[model samples]
Target chain A: MSDDGPRGQVGKDSFEARLKSAREKQGLDPKASDPDKRLSAPSAMGVGMRVGVELVSAMVVAVAIGWALDRWLHTSPAFLVVFVLLGFGAGLANLWRVMGPGRMPGAK
Target chain B: MPQLDFGNPLLLAQVVWLGIIFLVLYLLLSRWALPQVGAVLAHRAETIAADLDVARRAKEEADAAVAELTRATREAHAGAQAEIAAAVAAAKAKTDAESADLNAKLDAQIAAAEERIAVARTSALGALEQVAVETAREVVGRLIGSSLDPALVPQAVAGVLAARAK
Candidate 1:
């Protein structure tokens, strides 16, 4: 019975010390990231889709406009060829803007 | 196949239909779906902000409570240690006082025993002196016809006792 006294004291002291140390280690930060700051899997997928949409829209619009202009001016395939390359470049530009380091259309 | 031909009026009709469809889709999106999506996004942002504020307040309160608990625990430990020390001191004081009392009692008993031994020795010597004197008187009376003087007998006994002591 008497021997248990020192052991109990040691256990209690260690427990208190650990509690103090653990509490001291804790920081006051809220630990919640802003919902918009970092993209989750779904949001990242959404962003990727937007980029794809941008690229495809640019290419389609360019091709459509070039085709219509060629027909209207009787210029057979000249405008089509030039606009196709321009649309390809624009698509690449849109892709870069979407996926680049700025992360949220800030590059544009 | 006619789509590839520049003179095909069917291609013009197809282009017109594409524009019409694109316009309708854009109108639907701008009118209905986009506003809904924007509203949902706004609502989500508001909910998240509110949740974060609540979480921050809870975290701060928890930290404060933990800090207070640690403070109280430390104070309790100090108070307990002081109490244990005081108890130990009191116990030691009691033990010392008891030991001192026992030692004084033993000293008194030892002195009383010595006084008793001194008194017994003095009494035994006085009884031996009386026996020696009576023995000398009896021997002198038996040898010399019962006419021995008491004063002379005491003087002779004193002389013999002094010689034996030397």
Candidate 2:
């Protein structure tokens, strides 16, 4: 029985070794094999990119609204400057909301 | 050659009124309208983000739960299989042991019956031998004189036994 135990252990060791080698050959880490990790990284990056897109779009809309108001009011730069600043402030506030402590990229 | 002068008080008054109106409108927009819109937009965005985050987290949790359930299912399947196998093996062992015991009991019964038959056969043979001897004695008594001696009977019986042996 003791002899059989060692033989069984050796078989298991070789099988594990072969499996490890195969995984290494496939450029995979045994410990990092979780598929969730792969998805999470990309998802976080995508969220960050989305937030950036939202911020940029908000800035562009704010500027456009400000320009249109300036034209309508016949106030060349007054509304433009003021609304642009307000738009920037609004954009920053949005950014803070998106990227603040509890509103992290991956946070719920 | 402008009809109205640049320094006209009416024009200046109009500019002042416009400024005042603009300031009031700006104040109204900033203090009331813009803030409300901003709050609503912010709330909407937050709600959307929160919903998205909830969806993402739920998906992740669901995935994890599915993985865990799968693992548990596999483990349960394995455990059930092992238990079933053990039950079957135990049943088989019990059946084998019972069969062996039954076979042994049957063999013992057969042996006992054979021994009884042998004893009965021996007893029957002995009875048959005694009857044959009695019948032979009766035949000899009838064939010979009724007054035949007991001492001659032994000699007659010995002679018959010797002839039979030859």
Candidate 3:
């Protein structure tokens, strides 16, 4: 029983050391602090869909405007050809903006 | 095919009807359905934000409590260490003082015993010298049939005893 005194003291010291380390781990755990990695995983498909949508929407608007203008002026497809090129350029621009280097991670 | 037949008068009517239907659907969605959906979304967002705020506050309070606990533990540990050190020093001082007191007492007793032995030996030697002088004087008087000088007996005994000592 007397020997238990030192043994208990050693056990308590070890437990305190472990508790301190565990607390430190909790405070500075990288996974706990950076949740964007988890959020970005499931949204990988969403990012692709968003890029496609952005490119298509710009081209659709451009082509629609070009077609309307041509119909109004009674042109022989010259405006449509020019507008198609412009639409292609706009679509590329939209795609660049969607996946651009300047874009922030995890941004909507 | 009917849509592509621009010559058909019915196609024009169909177009007008389609426009009217599209406009109505758009109006319905924009005026009622979209706002309701937006309101639901806003309410959900507000609830989530409130919950997050509560969680953040709770976490902050927990961190503060942990910090306070750590500070208290460290202070208590330092206090305990200081008290233990003081106790150890006191014990050591007390033991040293006790041992020193014991050693002084033992030394004094040894010196007193040695002085007593020296005194006893000196007295015994004086008695032996007196006995030797008396015996020598008596034996010489008996052998020569005459009394000897007491001063001469003592001086001779002293000279012999001094020679024996050397």
Candidate 4:
């Protein structure tokens, strides 16, 4: 523009032509064809099933501990009730943690 | 009930098998499956991040290009407008100059025409005075039965006409 010469006009025209083609190319560019297309670990249903298994496993471990204690201490019913109730509460707590809002998605 | 008895030797065997199975499963998951799954997840994350990076760069480039285009277009538009204004100014100046020249010519013509009318008016008044003096000379000669001098008749007409103007 400052030159007001032939070369400046040529440069401006070429630049304008490039801009027009670039705009066309930009339109043609396929944007991020598969952005989130990746191997994800699991779905919500899978996570839910794992959480249920964790809850059940917690109760099963408590039951086993209670049974072993009863067998060793020779006190059967007394520990059974307390351990079973404890196991039930532990299972509930495990379920709560697994399904919590802050829990990571697809957590094992 | 017998199967439930912890004192049975079969219970010891069951516990050993359970430990062996758990160990094998743990190894399989920790050493093999978990790493494979983790690697896949990492690869996916890297791919997504790379795509996002490319997208950000492209967007920045596009924005800069668009800004450059807008600046160029504005400059071109301003140039065109200035050119148009210059053309209009040139035309207006030409028209103004032409009209000024025409006005001067018309004024000269009008002055010449007015001078001609003034000269015509003076000659017409001089002719009317001559005619009045001749008529008076003829009538006075008839009434008095004597002829009047031409110089005297003109002098008398001049006095009458001068008094009429007053």
Task: Judging by DockQ, tell me the better candidate of 3 and 4.
Answer: 3
Give the fraction of native contacts in model 3: 0.00
| Weakest lDDT window of 10 consecutive positions for candidate 2 chain B | B145-154
**Compared with the true structure, what per-residue lDDT tens digits does model 2 show for residues B33-137?**
999999998887677666555655665686688679868988999999999999999999999999999999999999999999989987876675566666667
What local distance difference test score does each model get?
A: 0.77, 0.73, 0.77, 0.79
Worst 10 residues of 3 chain B by lDDT: B48-57
Report the Cα lDDT for residue A45, model 1. Answer: 64
lDDT of model 2 at position A108: 25
Estimate the overall C-alpha local distance difference test score of candidate 3.
0.77
- lDDT by residue for model 3 over A1-108, one digit each (tens)? 347658866865775565445444444223335435533432667777777787778778888888898899989487888888898898888767756766534533
What order do candidates take by DockQ, descending?
A: 1, 3, 4, 2
Local accuracy of candidate 2 as per-residue lDDT tens digits, A49-92: 76677677777888898889889989888877887788778877
- List DockQ, one per candidate, in order: 0.07, 0.02, 0.06, 0.05
- iRMS, all models: 9.2, 15.7, 9.7, 8.6
What level of docking quality does candidate 2 show?
A: incorrect
**Comparing to the true complex, what docking class would candidate 3 get?**
incorrect
Stretches of candidate 1 above 4 Å error? Answer: A1-108, B4-20, B45-82, B143-166
Q: After superposition, how far is residue B64 of candidate 1 from its true place, in Å?
A: 6.2
Model 4 chain A: weakest 10-residue lDDT segment is A23-32
* Native interface contact recovery, all models: 0.00, 0.00, 0.00, 0.00
Model 4 compared with the native: what TM-score? 0.45
Among all candidates shown, the one with the greatest lDDT: 4
First chain TM-score in every candidate? Answer: 0.52, 0.48, 0.53, 0.53
TM-score of 3: 0.50
